[model samples]
Target: MDVALQALTVLAAIALGVRTKGLTVGLWGAAGVLVLVWVFGLPPGSVPTSAIFVIFAVVTAAGAMQAAGGIDYLVGIAQRVIRAHPNQVTFIAPYVAWLFATGAGTGFVYYSILPVIYEVAYGNKVRPERPMAIAPTASQMGITSSPVSSAMAIMVGLMAPLGFEITNILSIVLPSTAIAIGAAAFVQNKIGKPLDRDPVYQARLAAGEVTAPEPVDIGVASASAKRSTWIFGTGILLILAFGIFEGLRPVIPGADGPEPLAMTTMIQIIMLIVALVILLWCRTRSADVPRAQVFRSGMSAIIALWGVSWLANTFIAANEDSIVEGLGGIADNAPIFIAVALFIVAALTTSQSSATIAIIPIGITLGLEPWQLTAMWMAVIGLYTFPINGSQLATIELDATGSTRISRFVIYHSFTIGMLVMAVVSVLVGLGIGGIFYG
Candidate 1:
């Protein structure tokens, strides 16, 4: 009875949080923590300080890059590519979107290229939905694979203690997610009616509701833009080098033997250095960094992670024994339940970092192996299962031809099939790769 009541309290807090996004989710989570500690007499859990620092560091670098026009530089390149391969927009557009988000460490970059994608496809008479719907979905998938993303920060923090490295995580996620996007694009290319045959599009065309999309103007990349992008890319490569070849990092004397610097500390230091270099070399004003969209979104993510992770850790710590005993059998007999739980939580939270911080600890407590958890990590992409995501809504609005749309049944929106296919394929592919590594 006590455990059930406590679980109900956690659920209620999550419900309220999901209803009001941004800082409110964190506020509600803090409220839940208050109730749990004061009312239920539950002891507090350790704060996720390491994960928070990682997010702050990575976001700082990404924000600095954005402030220096690095994002614009990348978008210009994407525009050129899309325009160059107008006939293959459906097959090529999602990959470009995925690469942009992956490189920028934020999905907001996808918004810049959406217009280009729509213009290229609509101009070519290709069904706009074919590329428009899946492009944003592919952008979200990139977060799971991004080395500097908030979701990756939380994931690396969680798995590091278990002897896994960032390379291990990326090895499974990058290939799986890339392959998943291709599979989804192939399927999406077949589903929607061709632009000319679609009745709604034709009707809109006849009524003058659809106008020819204006050509996207991709201006030349500035010196600062090019400099910042190169600096940021170098930072990412350095981090990967450190992860892949531990010998590259400095060895510090320890209580036992000299050990290489910790990856978390290395990452924080590297990202901070990257930010400083961008500010100096790119001539970006310090004031502009905080105002960048990546900074704002990343800061908001930190708060949500702080509050929700605290609330969840507290509740789980208080009831760890009960939860493990109750669910351990299922975890052993049917490990897939672990992935399903992650998917459902991600869908409910609608924030990849929030979902990761909240549920991954519970999976750890359930005695699941790190490789097993990593194999299922891509399931967090389920955040797009609902059409309420900003990226999805933006995709719909950007399509002047009205091919990208939300169905009356919200679940049946334009992104559903692509999102579903990507989720299933990524997880399956991740499992296959994980087996080769740790099976």
Candidate 2:
């Protein structure tokens, strides 16, 4: 009875957070933690200080890059790429979205390119929904694969202690997610009616509600923009190099032996330097960094991760013995249940970092191998199960042609098929890659 009540408290907090959206999720999670500690008498768990600081550093650099026009420069390049392949916008657009998210280390960068995607598709008389719906899903999937993203930061922090390096995680995820995006795009191309045959779009066209897409004017990249983007790209490359070749890292004498600097600490140091370099060399004002969209979104993720992860960790710590006893046998026999749990939690939270911080630890405790858990990491894209995600809503609003839409049945929205396909394919591919690498 006590355990059941504690579980109910955690669920109720997550439900309220999802209902309210935005920063309130953190507030509600903190409230749940208070109740658990004061009312239920459970001890508080350790705060996720390492993950929080890594997110802060990475977001700082990304925000600095955005303030210095790096994101605009990248978006201009994406615009040209999509426009060049008008007929294949469905195939090209999602990959562009994924690339932007992976490079910028945040999916919010997908917003600037959304209108461009709509223009390219609509101008070609293709269904805007075909590309727009799946683009956001692809962007979200990119987060799991991004080295500097909050989800990846938390994942690295968790798995590094178990002998899994950043390279191993990325090796499994990057190829799997990239392949999954392609599979989803292929599936999405076959969905929906042709734009000319679509009644809603035709009706909108006849009524003059839909206008011809205006030419996208992604302004030329100024010197400042080009410099900042190159600097940021250099930073990402350096991080990847250090991760792939641990010998490149500085070694310090320790109590036992010389220890190479930890990747978590290295990431923080490098990103902080990157932010400072962009600010000084690119002539960007420090005041504008905090105001950047990526910074705002990243801060919200930190808050949500802090409260929710603390609550979850505390609850799990308090009931570790019981939880392991109850779920261990099932997990050992049917490991897919662990993936399903990750998917459901991700869908409920709608924040990849929060979902990761909250659930991955549980999987670890259930005696699952790090490779097994890593293989299932892409399952977090289930956040798209509902159409309430910001990117999904933005895509719907951006399509003036009325081709993209949510069905009366909420679950049957435009993004559903692509999201489902991506989830299934990525996990299967990840399992195969993980087996080769770690089996």
Clashing pairs in 2: none
Runs off by more than 4 Å, candidate 2: 253-255
Q: How would you encode candidate 2's per-residue C-alpha lDDT over 68-162 as one tens digit per residue?
A: 99999999998889889999999999999998889889888788889889988888888999999999999998899899999999999899888
Instruction: lDDT for model 2, please.
Output: 0.90
The alpha-carbon deviation from the true structure for residue 219 of candidate 2, after best TM-score superposition, in angstroms, is 0.4
RMSD of each: 1.1, 1.1
Give per-model TM-scores: 0.98, 0.98
Q: Find the 10 residues in a row with the least total lDDT in model 2.
A: 335-344
Per residue, candidate 1 scores C-alpha lDDT tens digits across 49-126 of 888998899999989999999999999998888888999998899999899888888999889999999988888889
The worst-scoring run of ten residues by lDDT in candidate 1 lies at: 335-344
lDDT of predicted model 1: 0.89
Tell me how far candidate 2 lies from the true structure as C-alpha RMSD in angstroms. Answer: 1.1
